[model samples]
Target: MILGTVLGLIIFGGIGEFSKSQKANSLGQVKYLIGVSYPNLNGPWQLQMNKEIKNEIARHDDTRVIFTDAAQNDEQQVQDIHSLMSYGIDLLIVSVDNASTLTPVISEVYKKIPVIVLGRGVKGYDYTLYIGSDNQLNGNMAAKEAIRLLGNKRGQIIEVEGNKESLQAEERSKGFRETIQRESKHSIIETINGNWLKDRAEDELKNLLKSGVKPDLIYAHNDAMALGAYQALKQLKIEGIKIIGTDGLNEESGGLRLVKQGIIDATYITPTGGTSAVQYAIDILHKVPGLPKKIILRNHEVTKSNVDSYLTEGDNSSIPFIKKKERKIKLGFAQVGSESEWRLANTDSIISAAKEAGVELILKNADYSQKKQMDIIRDFIKQKVDVIAFSPKTEDGWEEVLMEAKNAGIPIILSDREINVEDQTMWTSFIGSDFVEEGRRAGKWLVSDSKLTTTPLHIIEIEGTANSAPAVDRKQGFNEIIQQNSKFQLLQSYSGDFTLDQGKKWMKQALKTYGTEIDVVYAHNDDMALGAIKAIEDYGLKPGVDIKIISIDATIKAFNSLKLGKMNFTVECNPLLGPQLMKAVKDLENGIEIPQKIITAEETFDQKQSKKEFSRRAY
Candidate 1:
């Protein structure tokens, strides 16, 4: 038998001898085939798992293992499994595509080779061990965190569920629903299938928003889906909605970093599946019995308080703020110029922040001109900057510039205003305020305050630039609230063009025509309100005393005015976007794809609150 084994080794190489030794030694070192099913290889979890599986295969010197990626197809995965069995593989490891459809294939494979299911499991399978995190536990943990964060508030939740067909998805949804059901106080009013894609989630969320579903909390099965939900919330301008998700992969930073940055409230940890699967296969190969049929790894909840410990080495602050050792990267910026003081501050902050962060910035002022911005972008392409950052002056007229940037192999970071660019593949990520939420907060506040009043209040609105995104959003948000109130009415509205001069001129004319009938002034920005205040003073009407003033963009001037009782409420629009921009650039350089949009955290301030923080104010 030994001689025969040696001869087999000589004839068919080491693989043949390994097979012979398996039969002789009674170790049962059967040839095993592994099949991986994934939606995309671009995500962090898939990439990590692929690397781990490959490493495990290298370590298994005595057994032959065949690997295949199903690439997110149920039929393709079944065919791949059939092909593997045909190659004489003794065992099979499968991460299923569709739990239900793959049941038949798993049953078929089990007749030939013991099938071990990893990450996700199929029904009617009892052939092999299962190793993966408890997804149901993940859902429960997410719900606990959501309830803890919400405290006493009872509101509707929007569930961003994973792919409807996957068992993991079903299990997670089941867990979440069970937990919410147990609570009895809170309810999941609607659940949208995200299909485990960010873009898909965003679309579904946007549709729900347009249909007027007011969600107080959003729970996504995965971090990417959560990010998509965040984008939709921002675009629709919904405010005060808590967002949570799962998955804690290190490479993509997962939802942990998002929570730290206030983009998400929380995320649950889902262990990577590859390493566990490989270990299970090896245990079976060695004839190790008494192995637990099912291994469910515990889930961990990650929140803002404990996220810093999980920050990646590159993101660690111990490293100098900017990597001074590397070649200086030239960055181009196309900005929305002087739309508001906050806009100006945002531009200045990026320029200063990039420098502080050790990047050389080549600044270009679009001056709120889309044509000029396009020209500047083309010039930046000619200059071959490493990366480009721009705040689109308008939603349209950006595809050409974005295409040109993409052709140049330059990654683009969108700041503030979002573009109507159809090919989302053009930009790396967006970092800015939740414009719609800002509007919604303004609206909610207006409604709450107006509810206390007995008499009807006539309001004149000072709108932002006609074409600007914030202008359109702020108007929509204000009207969404005011229209619902019977005691509040908008007497007149005019575009201030986001300029003090335009605001002053427009207000003066409205004052001349309407006289003292206007009870309040709502400006899209603080600069415009300051101008409106001037117009009010010129007309001999006490500014805040006679006509209550409310505006967005709590610039220093605006806050100071609020403190002095000249402005009633100034919603904060912080222009400090430098940190997020630099982080995105670094993440891209490290080969990580950024999410579609990142909405900055914001708040509202009245005269009373402004007085407390006036001394510590930065902008």
Candidate 2:
């Protein structure tokens, strides 16, 4: 078949004279050639195929094969095929760039040499053989699995098709739609094209979200697309969306590894085209005929329960050591500085948590200075710490420090303050509260509990550190809620820098400025509220009597003050880091990967609830 294709190419003047001359001269030599569909080397599919092709070539003692990446260009692929044929390659393997556009090229090559097409098959052409997984069946399997895991509910499913122009993508969507239809209970609310690239898939998914399409289950044609969809869900702040995809490669790392880590629900097996193509090429070289015209590998679904089966010890293992080694882990911490009571509590918790976890902690205070934090990080590098943990003073200045740590092969974990680092490759993970959500909860509680009168209620806010992430996020969340209710008006605002003395100083100033105007005081942290209480009492205003109080960071002092009726409401920002920090460090030491962010669960508390849960509170 390949010989016929090559003859057609020669007759049509597709092959250059130089190629023809080479074909005539190298007729007796053992030559092999492979034509790949896309030139993207970073793509998992391309990398997998490259590995298998190289392995197959190494197995043959007298064979030499030249590889050509068509880079998803049809004309370039046709030219590559002709050049390969001209080189007198004994076996020709081709993965089509475009199934339809490459048909003529495949037909021409098939006339001169055996042509085995990899991945998506070409139409209007008969070849020596075709090898690829049944994409449609894989898609159907993914839908079925998603339905089964989702209890066959009638929730919306979003199908992310790869390269809408590609035949495989069309087939996959068809099978998925058909399967959902047959299930009767399942529904597909929307479908978007991912283009089989992570960045493009994420952008498309984001656009879909903006259009008000909320998907319960996101099914992508490939793992890369699935991961992209997951990222979109995270960015949109949508939770409980189950994601599934195809290509069960390695579950311990890469896309499959993410699946095992509970990032995605499952993945279906779509055998790498490279392995089968190379195997078939070798068979043809040995004069094997009557090979299957179409080769389809069985599809296997990989879920969390069975993910470990696909992860070999050597393949997905994070730690190479079989036995536990007693090595000291030098740790560096760049705190948000002692700005708020919560910040101090968080810092103290980290120190205490490390001591309890048995991790050698090398602490550094950024002094709320980004430059100082960067310098501290450099010091940590000089100390050669095994791991570094930091709560960046601000979001932007840590890139240099992060790079230095990265270069030194130190894994960094973020805590408390969220640096504006978008690169997931930089840090191992983050562990802290969802500051925005925490603020939202605080706002909702305040709005729900406050007594509504005909008069607009006056509120005075004592904010934490002005530049800190939590302060910004908490303020934003509070404003978002307050804006929804016109009855609630912020009379005045002042930053106490999260210190008791500053809070007292600001409260005194506010009292002198807005005498009887302030009816309620909302402090970002409890310590600030405690200080404000002293000022209120000093001004002959009875605590929790003349003006109600609402504060966050339900520390022990905050709870105790609530019991004394000094504070009206205290949102629980449990500072108990022993359990969570220990778990994170242990996982890292054991070479077990953790999630990118670990949000500590929290709840709101008022005087009534605070009294009931105070004794049980660990922090």
Candidate 3:
């Protein structure tokens, strides 16, 4: 890895150089010695992180930093951590040597000094805080960019992975494979363990070429391995293959330069999060509250288009402050119970996004009860939080509580479901799906399908909760579309209560009445459709064929059903609206006008095509 070559020099040059760099600070009485340990001194990521740490310490006159390089040895890293504490260091910063064994040592160290772990995270322990980029997002974005470049064509991908023990290796690998699996035209022919090193990567690529396995692209975990892969390809007289990698290190030999020279096609700028780590460390030293237990610094993309601009940019300068001037914004949310797969996934998105944004979220589950949701919202108003958000179970009964919120001058964001409110000024915005459009899309797909057209169709509708906006709007939209078709017959329509059991029971009765006469089943959402599929199977009828199944809400359960050829189609009702909600909150706080309703994007999915994206499904 280029990162390795850049940073490795620091270790071989000797640790004395570290002391010389901090010589000026030695004159002052060291109030604190923040012990820092890195697993690998050879990588640029480690080098940059440590440099930022020292720079941050340079600003704090009362604090000095002590450093150690484990040289990728887990045992040495563990031992170094102990000795640093023995020297009476006030705290420890560890980028672990090994994610597994080193966790025990880290856990022990935390009992003494507050631990701020970076990069290679250990499992089964709770340290003070973890600081790093979301490696999974890195992998995911790389895969998507590669797919875009290789559009509508078959390609062989040679994946070069980081060290197996590293968390980035697991997350990046998973993200890449998950998306690649869904893109049928592309395949990972083989994965070479690069160990985040350049020489190893070169050797691996050379061997692959010698074996006559042609690769269309090379994907490395870091810029060094990517450079190695590019060199090996050049030596073999192979050209025109796109090479993708991570760690957008902006140096002569790093990703930015390589990308500018057209050596690497693209790279994800995985921030070292060192500056944030130092800032967080300072916060702990000052006993600041409201700092998150974890901090995931954002990652960015680098390509040929703006490589020069990126290269020109300097380091993020610090305006050091003992305490941040802006207090943490508290957000309150009333989540609907995990009644279905869609609801569960929505909750996950909100929680993860809030944590990442460093917003203090006061969350409550209403368990799909109107009374409970009202109480939750009322409590949020009482708490006087800056912003309040919720996904209501029913459209009714929110008017009173929403009015109370408006009276207190707190902005409200109605998530997923918009309620029956008289005053439009009561809520700031609605961030969710356009249910009516989702319904129309589903109906249109059924109407346009070659198999279902020109036939007298017996359609059985599985309605959701009686008064839910999704249920009512979806039914209305379907009715509006199918009303003109005389051949389309409503065989038997009833409420399934949006429950799997109820759907099964209703379908069982429908089966007894219609038998194979039921040609189509339009479920309000995926859960009911999944339930009806079970009921269809129990009656010895093959779903997606003898009786076509169509539903809304493109969730994991729905995807699995579609993949198995058990469900015919599902109109996507996307639930991952958390990031947008956070942005809206920030915009509102800045006195910017947000739209009254922020309608989310939706898509259509069929069994054959939806199979391609099942691996990438978050829910």
Number of the top candidate by lDDT? 3
Evaluate residue 199 in candidate 2 and report its C-alpha lDDT on the 0 to 100 scale: 81
Tens-digit lDDT string for candidate 3 (323-395): 2228777889999788888888889889888998878889999988889988998888788788899988888
Residue 377 in candidate 1, Cα distance off native in Å: 0.7
Model 2 lowest lDDT segment of ten: 314-323
lDDT (Cα, tens digit) per residue for candidate 2, span 93-116: 776536777788788878877887
Where does model 3 exceed 4 Å of error?
A: 1-28, 314-619
Would you estimate the TM-scores of all the predictions? 0.52, 0.51, 0.54
Give residue 12's error in model 1 in angstroms.
Answer: 49
- Model 3: lowest-lDDT 10 consecutive positions: 316-325
In angstroms, the error of model 1 at 205 is: 23
lDDT of each: 0.74, 0.72, 0.79
Number of colliding residue pairs in each model: 2, 20, 7
| Cα error of candidate 2 at position 175, Å | 29
Alpha-carbon shift of residue 535 in model 1 (angstroms): 0.4
